[model samples]
Each structure stands twice: as C-alpha cells, then as structure tokens.
Target: MNAPAIPMIFSAHRRTLRLTRARHRSAGSDAARFIAEDMIEDTLERLAFLRHEPARALVLGDSTGTLVASLREQGAAVEEPAALDLEAPHPSGGYELIVVFGLLDAVNDLPGALIHLRNALAPGGLVMTHFVGGQSLPALRAAMFAAEPDRPAARIHPLVDPRAAPGLLQRAGWKDPVVDTHTLTVRYASLDRLVADLRDQGLGNALAKPAAPLGKTALARARAAFAARADADGKTAETFEIITLTGRRSLAGT
Candidate 1:
C-alpha cells in the first residue's frame, strides 16, 4: 500500500482509527509526520481572503494543539478537538466554522458525516474537510505487490477522488460546495524511512482486519523492489495529493 492514499471505501474499524490517532495526542511534534496540518493552514489563509473567520469554531481530528491555538489566536472561541465520531452530530449548532483536519477518508459513512457536520453548524457556517487522494505513490504500491506477488492483502485505503466530491457535497445539502486537490512530491532515501514517516503521521493500520506484517523474506524482496525505483541520487520519489472539500451551511436550508 502506498503511504499517501486515503481510505475512501474503507473497512476501517472506528476503534482502530481512534487508537491510532490517540498516539499523536501524547507525542511531541507532528511536523512532517503528516501533510494535512500545513494544508489546513493554507486553506484557512484562503478563507481569510474571503473575510471568513470563525466566531465560534470547532476543529475535529486535530493531532496537534497548533490549529486549536491558531483559532484562539485569531480570537475565535474554539472547542478543543478530539477523536469524535463524525457521523454523530453535536447537539450544539452555533459554530461559525468547523474544520476536519485529517479523518474524513476513513469514515464509515461519508455523506452521513458531512450531514452531521452541517447540522452542527449555525446558518451560514462553513466546513472544510481535508484528506489525501489522487494517484499517490505508485512505486510504493508496486513494491508492496513485489513483496507478496501472489497474494497481497489490502493495506492501503483507496481515497475518494476529488472529482466526485462536489456531487457528494450537494447530496449532503452543503451550499456552494467546493472541492480541490494539491500535489506534493517528496523524495526518500529508503522504504524504511518512508514507513517510519507514515507511522509518525499517525497512519498506522486502521483496517478492520489489517494484514499481518510481511515475513523477513518477503520484507527483503519488498526492500529490493522498492530500492529498484531509486533515482540516480539513490532516492525514490513519492507523490502526495491533498484534497480539500469546503461548503457552507445554508441560511435558507438549501
């Protein structure tokens, strides 16, 4: 499985995902561990251009305190983020903005989750959900197949395509739905470093039934296959595609 793909049609058990994300809460810096934080900040900056700033904000799935702090620094009264269920709508509905930092891909019910987010917002509020998508890390995926050429179990989640997001947003009753994608290319020295970076990003296995780790022989083959893709500089390139979905809760309930 490529490190950059998001779990779109995922059989991810919610408990497993929660457990995986919990590690970040007690851990130190999340820098470079994942790419969503930086993208979230960028999206916020874009929002600022539209004169959009939250008076009462809620940030879901924030691994670090930085985003929460940033909201407060901007004078928004923000509710501290947690590993809350996206399908379950919050009873309170006065938030001017809601940001889902890194958990939308693995959700069990994408439309239901979006609806819950919409319902949790006050009229004219905005919700922005970010995740990884598009064709990411083809080399890594090929290497994984080389690891178990015959019977490779599923490990990576197939993230939702950004192209389909606008329709989904409309189905969920989001007004002026917007969906966009950004790409980042990173070079790595070895697969080990790549795997480490993934774990650091709180991207451990969240599958309902995760495949067992590859045996030593299979791992060796995987390493060799991965190494074969290295460039002249002895580094391999990986692509990360970030998808952002933004919409407004309609005042007229459209």
Candidate 2:
C-alpha cells in the first residue's frame, strides 16, 4: 500500500518559512538573532511570573530556531514546526505549551489555525500567540493606498483588530482567552529606509490582487505626505500594533 500524501494546501504556506530564513541569512546582521533572543527572554519571563512549568513546548513557525533553542536550554522538549498554515490535523500527543509568534498574519486560514492549535494542547495547556494587528503602520498603509488609489489590490494585508482577537480564541474552544495590545515604535530616517525594513522582515505586501503601481507624480505626492507627518526629530515614526493573545485548552472536555 502507498503512504498517504501530505496535504497540498499547506505547501505554499510552508514556503513562507523558507522565505523568512532567506531574509535573515541575507541580512547578515545580528538583527534576526537579536529579535529571536529578545522574544525568548520575554516569553520565559512571562511564563515564570505565571508560575508555569513548561515540560513540553511547541514553537510554531520557528523560522530561525531562536525560541526553540531557548526552550531546549530550559530542558523542555521542543518541536519547531515550519508549516505556516496550521490547517493540517493536530498530532495525537498533547503539548504543555504552544508559542506562535509572528505567523498568524500570513496564514490564510486564521480560524482553522486557531482550532488546530487548541486541539493540539493538553488539558489546561496554554497557547500564546503574538501577531501584528489593528491599524499597524497606518501611515505606510495610507501612503501606499494613496500612491495607487485606483488599484485597491495594492492594499496591504488585512490585520486582525486587537479587540476581536480574544473572541476568536474563545470561539475556537479555548477557555479563559485574553488579548492585549502593544505598539512598537520604530523610527526611520526616511521612507526608503522604512520600506527596506519591511522588506527585510518579509513583510512586503502580498496582496492577491495588487493595485497598479503608482506613477511618478503619485509616488512623489505620497512621499511628501509621509515626510510631512515625520516627528520634529526628522524621523518617520512607524507603529506596529502587536496583539498578544493567550488561552488554555478546556480541562472539562479533556
């Protein structure tokens, strides 16, 4: 008998992980490594404060292996899965904790992803997810939108509203879901620099239907509008609203 084929719908999503690694390698800076380090430290601190003992953890979208490395250091058996969509069926065994950082925005099946995440957790297992949401980079979004007003296809990816994320967790059968938001302010010297950052972060707009490119006149106008909003210090302020959602598998069902 032939072995069953793995799902094909998730293949494209998995390629995103490879793309993320390429960006990090091409950057050749400590930036990616540093971001991973900071993420792990913050997560560990949060877990400690909650008096949680992590025995087995799964780090979703562990592109660069930073979080997985840290969890392994803490003596927790860690599984770093590269699949991005999370549409596949959950594994039979349960994980004590699941950490998903910076992946949901790119996943096509957000609701299905959450369901799979919940199903993978053991009774009372906690799931922590962090993603960009709610008016993040509005200035940039506005500029891009204005650049090619005729083409709505050029609009960036739709972000989840922070206010609605907690409810999504609950609807997915998680218990005690909580959602919180924070803004990351990054100052750039110019619009070009900001665009560069976005590219390096693998955040370039991937709209299925992209708007037409802005003509020279429109591009100039958009640039002027962005710089006009720059701070007195001559730095453009880019805001990324990060939504952190946490929930636990219902103990009553398991």
Best by lDDT: 1
**Poorly placed runs, candidate 2 (over 4 Å):** 1-23, 30-41, 210-218
User: lDDT per residue, candidate 2, 47-145, as tens digits?
Assistant: 888877779988875545666877788889988755534665676548889998666766656677898988889888988887678778878877776
- For candidate 1, what's the RMSD? 5.3
Clashing pairs in 1: none
CA lDDT scores, all candidates in order: 0.75, 0.70
Residue-wise C-alpha lDDT for candidate 1, range 1-254, written one tens digit per residue: 65555444544465345435544543755435457466657766877877898899988766656678888999999995445767677767778888876677777678888999988888999888887775766767888899999999787766678888888899999988888888878898888887766655555556666689989999999889988999999999888788888899989654
List the candidate 1 regions with Cα displacement exceeding 4 Å: 1-31
Q: Report, for all candidates in order, the number of backbone clashes.
A: 0, 3
Model 1 accuracy (lDDT, Cα): 0.75
Task: Estimate the TM-score for candidate 1.
Answer: 0.88
Cα error of candidate 1 at position 3, Å: 34
1, model 2: CA deviation in Å?
36
Residue 215 deviation, candidate 2, in Å?
5.2
